[model samples]
Target: MSPGASPWVLASPDVREETAMHDHRRIGRELDLFDTDPLIGAGLPYWLPDGGAVRHALEEYIRTAERRAGYRHVYSPVLGKRELYEISGHWSHYSDDMFPPMDVGGEQVVLRPSLCPHHALIYRSRSHSYRELPLRMAELGGMYRSELSGVLGGLTRVRAIQLNDAHIFCTLDQVTDEAHAALEMIGRAYEALGIAPSRHRLSLPGPGGKYVAAPGMWERATALLTDVLDRSGLPYEAAEGEAAFYGPKIDIQVADGAGRESTLSTVQIDFHQPEQFDLHYIGADGVKHRPVMVHRSIIGSVERAVAHLIEAHGGAFPAWLAPVQVAVLPVSDAESEHAEAFARRCREQDLRAEVAEAERGSLGARIRQARLVPYQAVIGPKEAVDGEVALRLRDGRRPDPLPVGEALARIGVLVSSHSTALWDDGDGA
Candidate 1:
């Protein structure tokens, strides 16, 4: 096997029969990661305990990364007045994919299909100087899509989405630098998450498509994104009619186990929204100037991102991302207290550790049950007496036993550093 590749593979056979299984859907069910019910209806799935844990880890990771990149996080409502969508151009150009509007005491409010309009309102709420340009705002916000019943399946194509959305308001001259920085952030995030984007496409508005009438605006935005892709030295293609109705964008695509490609992350440059919302900042000359809206998502949506991670890693998540990083198992009831204490210690250290129920069956059975866990700590009579742990990795490697503290420290380092290796024992760390 390739170095550090997981052995606990989830079955991802392609659809051939009516009962054929998809990778994440099958494993998610078996592991209780997520579920679907007739009551909740199709296209809307609720995450079980394990799935919620995984999503929490991913959300925390994204928030930290965004904060480090100088993005200020915000909370925005999921519903917006119909006029907001109109000003953002979603109503005129892309209303088909949006949910119907609702009348609340005479005001028509719609479930926001996107977060840009509200963010634009936030920017317009206050005046800014040129020095405050390139203001980065981010949110892990919920949005809805009016997807057809035939198209909805699993976490990938869902009606409701928790998007990792961000918009950078910057001066025109800073567009290239901002776009470059956004792509770099995406690269670092993808590397840490083990996502290999299949391709990068420059999505442009094609003929006979609804788009902003400003040809100059389209030209500038596409050229700027093209330059960003050029300087990054990444291969990309141009796809017609794939750009947002407002402007052009860079779409990072990923393929599923079935060989179907879908957009994973995106970096879009829009010059139209500033004018539509009349958003501006004061220049050094004390004159008002328009700011560019650079929209990008490190991981487009929590659902789609998790779906890809499940497929990519085959449900054997890395230590940091695993729902349960370590499973503590005792050989018999004698070591139950010791095992529970060890698990508690792990929890105190911010590590996700759980003691497997002994009565569930034999040691072999419990081990098989937690086969996807990154690390397993087995405490037998000798281990309990000596305060040591028999460390077994999910990859089927068993090393010599070590003191409880030392074993915990090793796993702590791996999880905190997001290292894919089972244990870093040297300078390789």
Candidate 2:
């Protein structure tokens, strides 16, 4: 074993193939990704610079994905009036899930548990048109909810989180198509992240139980989703009563490092909220009709997604998502200038690259350190004196020589693709 390889890294096969949660925790702490600052309180993570980059990348990825699918991004506050929750019916259904209110002036304010109410208000801001049948609004929304300390686990479960939330207001006639689009978007997201479809599950809570609001609506919505899933040929299993209080949902679950299951994406149909909020739009007939609302999170929350990614990739991360994709080392002081120049070229190609100062340690020692962080270490040597680099990948790969310019161009293309193609493992059969 390599000197730095820990038992945790060897005994765990997922870490070598794909990161599991336990592997993620070990790697996260070692990489200084996030920390629980006891002084800062519990269930909250203070993301270090490197960890923050991972979080930001997640947000960026979701934002771009939603935008391409006709979703507009928006922002909502972390706090709202107590009445807001009541109006949205969240208080009655999920009172226990929420934090207690804060006395403000003469009224009570509660930390927002979810962004649905705020997004609903946005929908009510003006009279919508049938031509704008599907108005999709999204937010990398920060929300807070009180939780017992025992339940918090690194970034997986947090007191505060930035939910990749979106609300789609579409006519009842547009429901199936809009839902199809949303589910497609979710599949594409998981695919891009290299998450096997077998790791993806679409959960639907079966009927014959209480709280299936508006029987007709529930039936229609469930049928639509079932049809979509079947037509898409995506493998999924239904879990009865797994639907949200408002409607049935397509829950996308992925296996974490430790072989545990967790929701990574979701698409929910809401028939209750629109009626409760009296949300409507002018139809082609100039008559008012209630628009159905669809809620989705391709990657549920940045904090949780980061946790999943860390575990999924065992902190090694894919080339595109790696915090430091490439680390350049100058074998000798004479190579420092050349190494710096080459690193800049890599950066210009949109690759995350950095130069490790020779002052830090021996070139070999730094090379090993780079592997610990699991970066592809590029060493500058005599052969690199002519603007070339001795490239090495993380997994103990042999070195190769390439011109600085050509390497940068290739790296840029690879990173920009942001994903690799592999056979769809469709939910582990």
Candidate 3:
């Protein structure tokens, strides 16, 4: 075997079968990630303990990265008066995707379909000088949309979702640079998670889409973004009709096991919303000027990203992201005390580890159970007596043999750093 071929290698057919698009629903359950309840309605998911843990970790991870990139967290209400969408041109273009308004106090109120309209309202609620040009407002806001039942699948398609959504408001001149920074930050996020950047396509769309208020402005915006992607050495493809009604976008596409591409993220440029909302900032000359807006979602939707991660990792997540990172098994009653101590140490380090007491069944059976849950570390007397623990990998059967302290330390570092060593195929193998 190659010195560092992933410890979790599977037969080529197994990899293909596991990643196939049709297998995601089954894998979600097998991973103990999430489930759907018919009574709760279609296109919605109920996350179990492990699934919820994964979502929380993802939120913390993205939030930290956003803050480091200078994004300010903002919260917006889940429902809004019907007028907000009108002012943002969403009513004219995307009204079909929005939940129908309900009668409340003789006024129409609808669940929010997107965060941009709210962000625009926030911008208009304040008067700004040029210094406040690039106002980066980010939110993990829950949104509701009227999606077709047939299209919903697990977390990939949902009526209700908490989106890692953000909008960047910048002057025309600052647009390119701010955009570059955001894209680079997003790329880094995927990298840390062991997601291969090359798997995605950066897509640009044409100007003729409906409700695109100004063709000239659209052309200019798309050109600027095209230049940005080129300068960054990013490869992209153009899709004629994929642009949003108000602006053009860069669609991040990924392929499933069957090799079919699906959009994973979106970065859009808009020169129209500012005009529609009458948004402005005072320029150096003290005259009012509209700030350009870029609507971006690194992972698009939390639900969708979760689905992709499940399929990509084939239910065996990395240490940092795994719900149960380690499981300890004592060889017999005599080793139970030592096993408990080991599990406690792992917990103290913020690692998710559990101790399994001496059981009635065989060791092989116990081992199978451990593998079923797929722990990152599996410890027993064999390991304890040898002063080592068996490090289980999602993709491998043979655990790493290492001293207890050393194993814990290594796994701790990996989890803490959210490391994914799998992506480091330097030889391009």
Candidate 4:
């Protein structure tokens, strides 16, 4: 067996079954969501169609949310010059976690470990006034870190990560409000995904000089975040030395179905990067001033979020987020054409639907397999002739038959609104 292969694969059937039920790796394989290949190197995953769909949906959801919250999305390159990191202080303190620099045309460049530095450069690309004070720049950018091989797990600890990263540039006076806004966004995102944040951590600097900001700056920034959390009536514990190399931050910890807490969202108050990049904006007095940088992410990493979602929902995704939201299963070969037509109709309504062809299994077996989908539309002769479908929900609830048009309308509403509920009873199905 491969060194990384699961030992459960060699165990008894019962043992394997019990353990594999909650294993994201096994569930990902069974659902054909993603895969890793030795030839492609460890810690790098290739998203299959199903996994790609889930990631795409998540990206769209976050982009829309950020946009509505006044965030402007931007694309930045993954690789940067060595001088860039040196100026940003990443080379001095964070180089150990970053990949080795490559010599390209006698100049050293490396993959970015985070998107904050790139966004800082973008902010400096333009001259702005205080009117643009709360400038929110967002990106769903990919990053690479030199994580240890032993620490790399399925999606949770991959070397490559696509971050839902953003930075808010504002005056020091606006720090508290921006941080509060970030927290509100985080809460909305978690509620939409049906994941509850267990606790919050006000990560502060330690006694050492590992942090880039001066002691006074660190204290001020930490105080600002603390006041924001307190005023918002949030309960959070202070964790000394848990601050990032650059600044203090608020970490939102969420628990998965397995009850393991992971930090998936964060809001960091950065006072050092602006100094490193010399980022500035003109105030109403017509003088240059440095803007405080608020680094935040609602969903820190898309890969890890999907991994958590897989376990949180036991591979049964919500209707809007599921790769294949509906499966049309025909009762027999005679109803195959109708099933295909019904699936196509669902597709026309913007639903991810597929027809489960009855080729190698009985109707009962096919229905059982189709039940894995969030919604299953069974097409028998009578239902097919009447243009109606018997809906079997993933939760084992069988709603009454409804016309195909009405069913498609209800599904559209469920998807468009991003509802976590299986299906609404108001549909009168």
Candidate 4 ranges beyond 4 A from true positions: 1-20, 427-429
Residues 144-208 of candidate 4 have per-residue lDDT tens digits of 98999998889988999999999999998999999999999998888788777778988877777
Better of 2 and 3 by lDDT: 3
TM-score-superior candidate, 1 or 4: 1
lDDT of 2 at 101: 91
Candidate 1: TM-score?
0.94
How well is each residue in 63-160 modelled by candidate 2, as lDDT tens digits? 88788888888887888999988888888777787899999999999989899999999899998999987999999888987888888778877888
Error of 2 at 203 (Å): 4.1
Query: Could you estimate the TM-score for every candidate?
Result: 0.94, 0.88, 0.87, 0.93
| Higher-ranked by TM-score: 1 or 3 | 1
Q: What pairs collide in candidate 4?
A: none
| Residue 141 displacement in candidate 3 (angstroms) | 1.1
Candidate 2: where are CA atoms >4 Å away? 1-21, 197-213, 372-381, 396-400, 421-429
Candidate 3 Cα misplacement greater than 4 A, ranges? 1-22, 197-209, 372-406, 422-429
Candidate lDDT scores, in order, read 0.89, 0.75, 0.76, 0.87
User: How many clashes show up in model 3?
Assistant: 2
- Sort the candidates on TM-score, descending order: 1, 4, 2, 3
Candidate 3: C-alpha RMSD after superposition = 6.3
